[model samples]
Target chain A: MSYKAKFRVWRGEGGEGKLEDFTVEVNEGEVVLDIIHRLQATQAPDLAVRWNCKAGKCGSCSMEINGKPKLGCMTRMSTFSEDETITVTPMRTFPVIKDLVTDVSFNYQKAREIPSFTPPANVQPGEYRMQQIDVERSQEFRKCIECFMCNNVCHVIRDHEENKPEFAGPRFLMRIAELDMHPYDVADRKDAAQEEHGLGYCNITKCCTEVCPEHIKITDNALIPMKERVVDRKYDPLVWLGNKIFKRSSSKS
Target chain B: MTQTTADSPARRQRAQIKERTLRTDQWWRYPLVTFIIFTAFLVYSTWAIFDTSYFASPYIAPYASPCLATSCPEGARLFGLAPFGDWYTLPPGLLILALPAGFRFTCYYYRKAYYRGFWLSPPACAVNEPHGKYTGESRFPLILQNIHRYFFYAAIVIGLILAWDAVLALVEKPVGLGTLILVVNAVFINLYTLSCHSCRHITAGRLNHFSKHPVRYRAWGFVSKLNAKHQQLALISMFTVVGADLYVRLVAKGIVNFPFA
Candidate 1:
């Protein structure tokens, strides 16, 4: 006899939700995503779960499977025991719009707070003279497919719901860090990062680092360094003195 | 054709040979080479730390002293050896090296690649085997190295302090020492940031299996090599900065003589 696996999928829209169970025949080469699609076709034709490309690259099928933020398509059903029942739910960080879809517009808003790049004054269009090494640093940030898995897993907004309004979360901070590290970006956004974006709230527990699908060093490379820069302007005695001296010199001139 | 070969030892031996040959390559394909390079860096750092020192007092060279015309009390105090001078020199120097090393290890790229054993022993083909129950035991200390996030905050704070000290050295007109420390801090920051596992992971042109562009694959191949060995240099550069900082501090504290100072 072939093994059969049971899935408890979240069913309903908006505030209405219930776990509906469906038993499906398990195959050797099947992943969790294939089972979900199979259940949708055979049992629940009206199911409205979101997915794209059916590959890990699309970052669309992000949901909590077995209470963990992961791409449904990438998770293999074989990782579980035959007797175990798999529970799937929408990501908790955002408001659920349907059975397995959540609103992620908050991330887009936070992204806008960061100042866009401004090129240097003496620039000609043909080609900018940048060393290969200089451009190499920010290139890592461009890989983000906006999965928001890092945002979902973040404890600041995930566990403490109050932090949502103030906290910019890990994904956008990575964007800010990416822009800050850009060699061509002349504008300094560190002050805005502190005053407006609430970068200081991130205590560097690195929970976001653990769940990142792209494996971005959110706490280490981006957030921590940006915090350090803010602290320098705010607290460093020498910078304070330099600012004061510069102010006086400029006023006299 | 092979009906009579079922019980033959020669056929069995051939089967065994094929199985053994088919076994996946070891994670560290060139362990000896990696070991030698790491060992050389370790030895050099140890030597650099113990060899340098200077007196606690500060004095300005005649050429570019800021106190020449005005009553630069701040400049005078900095010019002559003081507690701030000692405080300024050693701790920040060691920090310069230690922070970058710590950050690199905890980098995001390293975490993912190391978890899957990608860097040391990437499969010859990009295809993954069918998922099964994960049977491996967790490797603890290596896994726990993700604490680099905490270290990054510490490194950044320390780097800023070191940069301030560099600024002080410049204002006091000690051009040589100022340049040395500044250059050391900059290099440490560069190496630390560059060798970042997270940085490497994100910069991957496109994944080999997913990329549609032919040029992206070639670029990814180049970047992947740098990503593979990034963790090693990340450690080396971090320790190098720390050793350099310690040497400067020992000299500033009068515990050793700075041949350059």
Candidate 2:
């Protein structure tokens, strides 16, 4: 059941590029990644594309398919109409290296900005106990594969590149939120998420959640809860009065 | 894996390099204008708060109304201040302001508005921000913004207070244009307060199932409808708050007396 499928892949380097069309053979159960591989094999040998595992786990095949941010390996070919021209473009937010690959250094930089998990003094590594409820909460955020699809679809920094410095995008913000939620982690992440990570920039459009190949609730579970935590500390009058009565009880001064 | 030769007519060469990687257009203009407008509003509000002449019928000035201290002029104290006694002789506006300010400051929409407008942390899309490193609101002062839900609750109470003020505006048995203005001001304030992101969340955040909590679901529905125009409400409330304060001030000062009583 091999069929010749059409693909319009943006081919270029250093930012300037255009969609170049090609027809490649699609096998019975092939995905976009298979057709991209075929495009590499048959028509354009010099065509540059980044992929690993071809099983969607690697998250290496991230690109905009028909203007939608998605993992090429995960996006089934059957989703599109047979006669439809499949448009595969490089992720628009970052600088294009060549063909479908774009420089994803922005995400890496944001990752570095976040302070890593800090266990409490009493709890040694592998000795700490977490309630199942607490464990499940962190587990939900732990499912992220760093696909950058969430990053790509995030409108906060996606179209707004200057916002890159301020906004940490959805993924890293969620990472901070995850660390804050961890039971044993004693560090005050609420402030860090607010001041350093640009947590305020996310408007909860849920585009990140929509594009997540991992199906993680990036908005509802992570971002919104993180927002709520910020509210609890800052605006809660009881907390305000408590701060006045018992000053500096916590590590955060 | 490619058997095809490296040089092929079918293989299109990548496009020429772009001169500048990012947008070259004027992206900073919008945020800059927003910055200017908000700054002006802050200045005007600060000036209005200090002006002791803001009272007309002791009910005219919304900002100074329910003035709790003994120092407040005749008929100004809606209630006496027993708890915060002798704290200061500052206008009740100082005591009353934090509610609406907190609501606006921590507002989801205002967070975005000010984050871009004042911070210039990007200012707008594709435009480089002034600062090299952005730490974000997870810190001490900024983390306080998280209490927006609490502020939402406070704003609702404050909105009720302002609405009461509107009712009291006509209690002297005078039918004047001031009465209409005060009523409209209260309406806008309520619109803004009810349309808050926290209000929307509070209405539905606790519910596991909408079908289980029909009332909250309906409340959320109304809040959502208002939330859609949240931006308009934010601006409208701002104008009304300032307008109501200024109107009372002028009338009390005998500067622009619109006599109907």
Candidate 3:
């Protein structure tokens, strides 16, 4: 089956843009990315879009569809009514380079801020051994394809640009949580997660978890557990007393 | 992708979009609904606390359980003990309401709900909040949410008391529909309490390795499973408690006659 689909794609450069409407042809089993490609081929020769793998794995085709953060490659034309007008816009959190493509360097900046896995001084790479259960704790987060949709949808930075300097958003915060939960990575991430990465800004709205394409429980399994773990160092009086009485040095210190 | 615009001044700033969000979907509906529900719960709980008619023999209202005052009906008194004597004139619910109330208020899930629903702190994901400044929970007052573990302990004690009340309802002569309701409410209370994020953490959160602590690992797994549904349990338990309290209140007022009462 073939039909014409309406599209309202945002087009602009240098931070100025408007939604430009296009009537594009659609085919059976075609995703939004396909219709977008068709628009580029037939109608608008100068349309700008960033895409790598159309298989929904590259995490390169992320755009807002009908006001929801989604992958253009994953959203099928079948999900929308034939007459419905689909709107494609660049992610609102970052600077726009051109149509349907926003500068995602903010995510890379936050990613760089987090300290990578630091193992014990004695344990070699091959010497590291952990239970399957421990591996599963962080395995859920490994599914993240760097979609950056979580960062885009997170309100801390999405609505407030000033917060960009403080909050790490959900994606990198989950990265810190993953390393913190690792059985062998001994660096103490609890303090740095709050003080440096702005873990405290997350009000646990779970919007990141909602928009996650990988179905990972980012809030439940990673963020909340990390928040509670932070309490062991910062808030728990009993833990403070125990540390004082025993004279045990923290992992990082 | 990184080399597309190097050292461009415009690349340093976010896109100058004028609209709060281009979202065409009804994003406002969620927070508005959440506001209405929380407000209704607050209003009903306020009324439930002040009303003294909270007992109907074998079934004590959850809000007024443990009937600490001497003014309480003899049949409704917990094991016929009045700890406060006649010195305390206020409602018994006033004495203990703070505990469960504190638990819910400090709950991680409820924090999200009320923050979005009531405070309008970026009500939905992309919507702009009216507030100009956002310090979040890092400061005083909101930072007190760290005391959630203490509230979790209090909630466990309250859950135990509610369980005892449910048992009393079961054993004290004929069981009515109120008995079933109270029992279900007690179950829900415990479920919500055990499913707490704090509970999940205390079980095994700080452990460096789960292999060494087999028992804590098992407990952590159970709590983690329950914690996934914490939001649903939070809402269900709230409504069930209200329903249980209202049922007992109506029976105490002689408004509704249950079979075998």
**lDDT (tens digit, per residue) of candidate 3 on A1-253:** 9999999998877577788899988999999999989989998888999999998888999998887899999999999999999988888888888888888988998999998999999999899988998778898899999989999998888877889999998999999999988888888899999899988888888889989999899998888888887887899998788778989654422
- Which residue runs does candidate 1 get wrong by more than 4 Å? A239-253, B1-261
Model 1 CAPRI rating? incorrect
Global local distance difference test of model 1:
0.55
What tens digits encode model 3's per-residue C-alpha lDDT throughout B1-261? 434465777665555667777777788888899899989999999999999889888889999987888888887787788888788999989888989999999999999888889998878876777888787877787888888999999999999999999998899844588888999999999999999999998888767678888999999999989988999999999999999999999998999985765
lDDT at residue B28 of model 2 (Cα atoms):
60
Model 3: per-residue Cα lDDT at residue B174: 42
Off by over 4 Å in 2: A1-95, A99-150, A153-168, A171-226, A229-253, B1-26, B79-87
The fnat of each candidate, in order, is 0.00, 0.10, 0.60
Tell me what TM-score chain A of model 1 achieves: 0.89
For DockQ, the strongest prediction is: 3
Task: Evaluate all candidate structures by whole-model CA lDDT and list the values in order.
Answer: 0.55, 0.72, 0.87
TM-scores, all models, native as reference: 0.50, 0.60, 0.96
The digit string of per-residue lDDT tens for model 1 on B129-214 reads: 22322211112444244344455556555455445445665555465553465456545555455444433332432121213334
Q: Alpha-carbon error at A228 in model 2, in Å?
A: 2.3
